[model samples]
Target chain A: MENKRNSQTIAEYIKNWSRKHSLFIMAYGTGCGAIEIPATLTSRYDAERLGIRGAATPRQADVLLITGYLATKTLKRVIRVYEQMQDPKYVIAFGSCTINGGMYYDSYNTINVLEKYIPVDVYINGCMPRPEAVIAGFQQLQDKIARGEADNGTRYKENLEWYRANQHRVIKNWRMPDYNW
Target chain B: MAREKETTLYIGPQHPGITGNMMVKVKVQGDTITNASVHVGYLHRAFEKLIERRNWLQSFTILCRFCVPEPDPMELTYARAVEEIEGREVPERAKYIRTMVMEMARLQSFMLWYGGQSGSSGLYTLGQWSVGDRNYLLDLFEDLTGGRIYHMYIWPGGVRRDLPKGFKDKALKTMDYIEKRLDEYDKLLFDNVIFQKRAQGVGIIPSDKAIEWGVVGAPLRGCGIKADVRIDEPYEAYDKADFIVPTFEGGDIWARAQVRRIEARQSISIIRQMLDKMPEGEVYNKVPNPMKWKIPAGEAWAKTESVRGEVGFYVVSDGSEYPRRVHVKGAAYTNGVTVTEKILVGQNIADVSFILNSMGVCPPEIER
Candidate 1:
């Protein structure tokens, strides 16, 4: 029992340390907030200094930064992207649209409250949050991961039935493959 | 070995080369494209339908989203359309400021173009340099309008606020800095042999088919046309300033890039002229209270020369607070879709995003 417990502690420490050091973001800019992303990632803000970088593909990404409002069509693609990402994944829902859909709340297309369909680990508030706010949000996510409080990816797996039901209801066409992983 | 078959590939909704969230489906045989289709609707938020629901003043907020990189043109076009419908007269100082803002947006957008075009071709240093330099303009915008990307500064009657003290000095200093940077950029990007070798004669848009395909902005200008809304239909303070509409003979990627580079220089000169001749007057002419405001029934079309090309807005207002219909005719509408499909045929698969970048195709505008 002591040996098993020690192994678990070592695993936790390594996981937390690695998670805090590197964050590969698949910045899906579905709205106006996408414009601020290049500013944050590039030399001016230098998100690389904090070990945050952009991943070209979802397969290699750690965090899915849903930049702004997600239209129904984009929401389908976002789900596919999220499912493709590896385990220990995170979702950083940016802007007011992800919270309650902001100005696009009444729009027929965009989904209100992204957390209903996906487990959002952090929410960055703004009409379109500035680069400073984005950096802060990343900091918060890093802190959460270090504390091992960032277990939403596991939560997603446990509540897979609920998340899938909600996702299927919104995405009408439902052409994508099943998220079994 | 007897027969060559075409294979299909999808480049997008998350592709690095693509500026935003649209996909391009290409059928290729041995690295050469045979047929192409642009799969948009990834970033479509139904802006037209959404605008119909919001009131006149409120609709301005969403206009900028039509094109992310250069948003002031969207704001200006929408504002001008409403102003014309209302027969509102803008103050002289406001006109000059609007002109300066538009020119600033043009300069910053060209910088963004440099980053995207170079970044796609494995020359990431240019992307790093240009995007880093673009922050200077963003800082100016943040100080002036309080938003870096979405500057909701322009309104129907006039701009939201007047220039702050020492705004001109700061703007001139930035302009001077940008001028020096432009020369360095020409050496780094425009004059590079590798870029020239890759861009020259690639993704050629035939001059004869330019009009039929509805190509506008740099793509059209790259085909040796002097067609510019600022010259043809001068709005704001464009008529007040003297500037040339730069054009090139070849309609390839290099030619388009050249057109953009020359236009960036012209924008600098225009901004200088605008600042020097700007009159001292009221910045804004306030409209009615937002909750109770109403616009009379009228239809108006306003077009402005955005960094991309001609950005036109056709707004129909009913005798109510909300618009009857707001149709944004973005330059990228035809460029990103029809022209992209037509031009991608028989070209190299690697140059897909290069061509798209050259055309200044903003995917959100295409989808919206």
Candidate 2:
């Protein structure tokens, strides 16, 4: 029993280590903050050195970087994209808009609290955070993964009903496919 | 040999190749697009409605968000509109500073376009090089204004502050560096055969139909017509500066690219002239307190030539602290929607994003 437990811990450590190193951010420029992503990933900041690269489709992406203020229209798509991302996925909410709707806090279209609908592992607060801040946020996420504390995906599954209620409240049409997970 | 059935393909509100949060629904027959329509509002923040609630002075903060890549021009247009409504004369020195800032904005925005255009065409090197070099310009903006992206430096009466110490020399040096780099870009991008073949014949907009469709700025000039807000209206210190409005004849992506390339060079020269002819005086004319400031009951429209095209702001005041209404007439509204859909039809499926970039279809400006 002791030998089996020790091997399981080693396997868990290996899995977390690999996951922490490769974070494929979905290349969905949802809002204004999308502009900074190129700056962060490109030559000057070079986010690739830290193992953060853009994944073209949601199915392949491991991280959903919600760039900025999401209108109710975009929130539906964001939920769809988040659900499509594979398991062990993480979210880094960028800008104050994602945190508390930033300058658009009172705007009728944008939601104030992003966490109400989706679980966020990190929040980088700025009207639009600089590339340095974005890189730092990724580092924080990497650290969380290393410590095995970045399990918001499981939390999302556990409270899927509550999250769906929040999503449904904003997205009135409710045309999305049912979550089977 | 049966006729291929047309299929509908949705390009994005989330796709990478797209400029921003907007979608294009295209009907394709085999590899060629037969019909196209643009769907916007993904990035809409109800800017016009929000501006109505804020007082005259406070509304400047929100104006800059209309266009993400270039915010200075939005501020300039709104400031010009407010100044017109109240008949507030900006200081001579402030006019020159405003002109310089606008030119700087044009340069950086064109840099972004260079990346977008080249990236869309599979030339990833230019995107990397241009966006990386764009940091120098962003550094200049950060030094002048407190923020990198959103610079609320231009206000109703005048600028927020005078040029900082050693700013002129630093700006001149940056210009020199950029001018040198533009040659390298020419060799790398303009001279390359693949880019030439891809851009030369694609996305053609005839000169006769361009004005009717409300195409303005570089894309208009690309159609062989000579029209520019700076040359035609001569706002700010543009009257004081000597520069020619560059025009090209192809009416295609290549012509638009060439128009921008020469305009970037012209902008550099214009900035140099503004610095040379700049008068020493106060940079700002202080308006009344923000909470109590009210404009006389009137309306005004102001226009400025941004990198994309002519960006105009119309402001209506009701003799109250808040504006009665605010409406933005951005070039993207016409180009991104009507012109984009019109041009995308009959083009190869691969060139949708390519043509969109060449037209400078900024989505936030469209939705805002």
Candidate 3:
């Protein structure tokens, strides 16, 4: 029993270490904050050196970067994408708007608090955070993943009922297939 | 010939090839598209409604969000509309600065468009190179406005600040670098036979319907209209400088690409002229505090020649802190939806993104 427990610990450490090094981001630049993402991913800042690259599909992505405000319409897609990603995924909410709706706070269509419906592992603050700040935020997520402390995906699974209740409350006309994992 | 059954293909809201968060539903018979429809609203944050809730100055922050790649024109148009309604006089220096900023925006936007256009055709090398080369322009914007993507530099009364020291020298140097780089891009993209074959006759925007469908910018210019808001309706210091509205006769993807190619050259020359002939004076005229400021009740319409086309704003003021109604007419509204749908039909599925990029549609502007 003791030998088996030790082997499991070693396996978990290797998994976390591998996960921290390679992050494929599905950057849904849904708002103004998305403008700077290309700047970060492209030659100038080059997030590729840090093992961060863009994934064409949600299933292949490990990190979901929601850049800027999420309208109710986009929120539906965001939830679907977050669910599609594999386990041990991380979410980075870019810009102040994601935290509390920065400029569009008073706007009727925007979703003020993203954390209410989706699990966010890191939040970058700025009206539209610069590439440097975006890189810093990615670094923070990497640190959390390496420490085995980024468990929002696990939390989301344990509280699926509560997350679903919150998600369904705001997203009217929800017609997504049941994602039985 | 046997009758062929049609199948539907949805190409984005998340596809890497499409410009932004918008989908194109195309009905195809084998490789040829029979019917195409645009489904946009993926990126909609309802800017028109949100602008009504905020005061005049507050609206500036959100205005740039309408068109991400070229935001300065939105800021310039909104500011000009408010200024026109109030009948305020802008400083001589501010007009030149506005022109300079607009040209810089045009230059960078073209760089971004180059990345998108070439990348759509599987020329990822040029996309990477141009996008990285574009960092030079962004660095200049950072020096001038203290922000990279959304400058919020061009506002009512005048600019937020004056040109920082040695800005002209840096801008001129960058322009020279870009001028040389354009030749390299020509050899790689324009002069290549593969790109020529892909873009030459694909996505033809018929000249007669071009005006009726409300197509503007390079697409219109590509059809041989030679119409430019900068020349036709001279705003700011555009009249102060001399520049040509380049036109090509084809109206196909190649023609439109040529127009943009020439315009990129024109932007470089215009910036050099503006810098040399720029008058030194106060950069801004003070407006009352945005928190308590109210303008006389009136309505005004203002337009500017953006990289994509004519971007206009119609502001109605009911003598209140918040605008009564702020309606944005982005260049992408017609191009991304109507024009794109029309041109996309009967083309190969492979050319969908290529033709769309040729039109220079910014998706956020369409839904916003």
Candidate 4:
């Protein structure tokens, strides 16, 4: 029994280590912050060197990097995308707009707080954070994944009702699929 | 002949190949698009309504957000409109600085276009190279103004500050490096067989229907028309600079690409002349306290030739610190919506994004 438990702990450690290295980011450029993302992913910043590459679809992506502000209409799509991703997923919200609405605080269509609607593992603060800051935010997430502290995906699944309430308040017409995950 | 069944396909609001957060709903029959329609407003922050509440000075901050890739033209147009309404004079040196800044913006915006156009067509190498090289221009912008993406330097009456120490030499050096790299890009991208094959006869905008559809900028020039706001109605220091407005016969993606290629060189030449001819003087003619500033009840329209096309600001003042109404006429408003929807019909579904990028469809500009 003791030997079996030891092998299971080793398997868990290996899983966490591999997950920390490879992050397929679904970069949803929701606002002005989207412009900075190309710089981060391209040759100058070379985010791929750190194993952070862009995924074309939500099912394949390990990380959802929300570039900036989300309008009510976009928020509905974002929630759908987030739910479509598989287990052990993470989210990195870029720009101050995602934190507290930034300059678009008073805009009627945009939401002030993003965390209330979706679980975020890291938040990079700026009007639009520079490429270096974006890389740093990814590194922070990498650290969290390695230490097994990043479990927002599970938290989201557990508190689906509360998130659905916040999402429904902003989105007037809710035609989303039921959250089975 | 038997007909294939029709099917509906939605491209974006999240697709990787799309220029920004906008959607294209296309009806296809056996891989050929029969009809297409553009759906925008994903990136809209309601900038026009937000501008209504801010004071005159505060409005400049949000103007840059109207079009993310090219923001300088928005600032220039708004400043020019306000200056015209107040009948304020911009110093000679300030004029030169503003002209130089706008040209730099045009160059950087073209770099982004090179990336987007090629990337959507499956040439990822060009996107990587051009976008990486674009950082040098961003570095120059960071030095002159405190910001990279949104400069907000151009203000009513004049610019916010003078050239930083040794800025001219730095800018000239960067321009030289970019010019040298343009040749390498020509070999890698413009001369490649696949790119030519994909771009040559696709997404054709017939010359006869170009103006009728409200096309402007490189896409219009690509239709063999010589319509440029700089030449027809010279603003700022453009009257002093000499440059050619390049035009091409074919209205396909290749023609637009050629128009932008030659135009980028002309921009470098114009920037060189503006730097050489720049005079020494105060950069700004200070206005009254910004919070309490007011102009006579009047309206003015000012336009600038941005990389995408003509970006105009129509400002109406109520003789108060706030503007009564501000309407923006962005090139994408016409080209991205009506022009794109009309052109995409009958084209292959594979070329949807390729055609969209060539027209310079910026979504924020469309929705804002």
Candidate No. with top lDDT = 4
Write down the DockQ of candidate 2.
Answer: 0.76
At residue B16, candidate 4 shows an lDDT of 88
What's the distance in Å from true for residue A4, model 3? 19
Model 3 has an lDDT value of 0.88
For the second chain, the TM-scores of the candidates in order are 0.98, 0.98, 0.98, 0.98
Candidate 3 vs candidate 4: which has greater DockQ? Answer: 4
Evaluated on CA atoms against the true complex, candidate 3 attains a DockQ of 0.58
Cα lDDT, model 3, residue B195 = 93
Tell me the tens digit of each residue's lDDT in model 3 across B1-368: 97547898878766777787788999998999999999987777878998998899989888988888888999999999999998878999999999999999999999998889876999988887788889999999999999888899987999989999999999999999999998899889999999999999889988999999999999999999988999999999999988888999889999999999988999999999999999989889989887998999999999999988998999999999999999988898898899999889889999999988999989888888
> Where does candidate 2 stray beyond 4 Å?
A1-8, B1-4
- Per-prediction DockQ comes to 0.64, 0.76, 0.58, 0.70
Model 3 lDDT tens row, A41-78: 88878999999999988889999888888888888888
Candidate ordering by DockQ (highest first)? 2, 4, 1, 3
Interface RMSD of each: 1.5, 0.8, 1.6, 1.0
| lDDT computed for candidate 2 | 0.90
TM-score of every model versus the real structure: 0.96, 0.97, 0.95, 0.97
Q: Please give the distance, in angstroms, between residue A97's alpha carbon in candidate 3 and its true position after superposition.
A: 1.3
Q: After superposition, how far is residue B65 of candidate 2 from its true place, in Å?
A: 0.6
Residue-level lDDT of model 4, residues B1-368, one tens digit each, is 76536898888888887898999999998899998999987887888999999988899989998899999999999999999999999999999999999999999999999889767988888889899999999999999998989999999989999999999999999999999988888888888998899999999999999999999999999999999999989999999999999999999999999999999999999999999999999999999999999988899999999998998999999999999899999989888999999999989999999999999999989988
How does model 4 score on DockQ?
A: 0.70
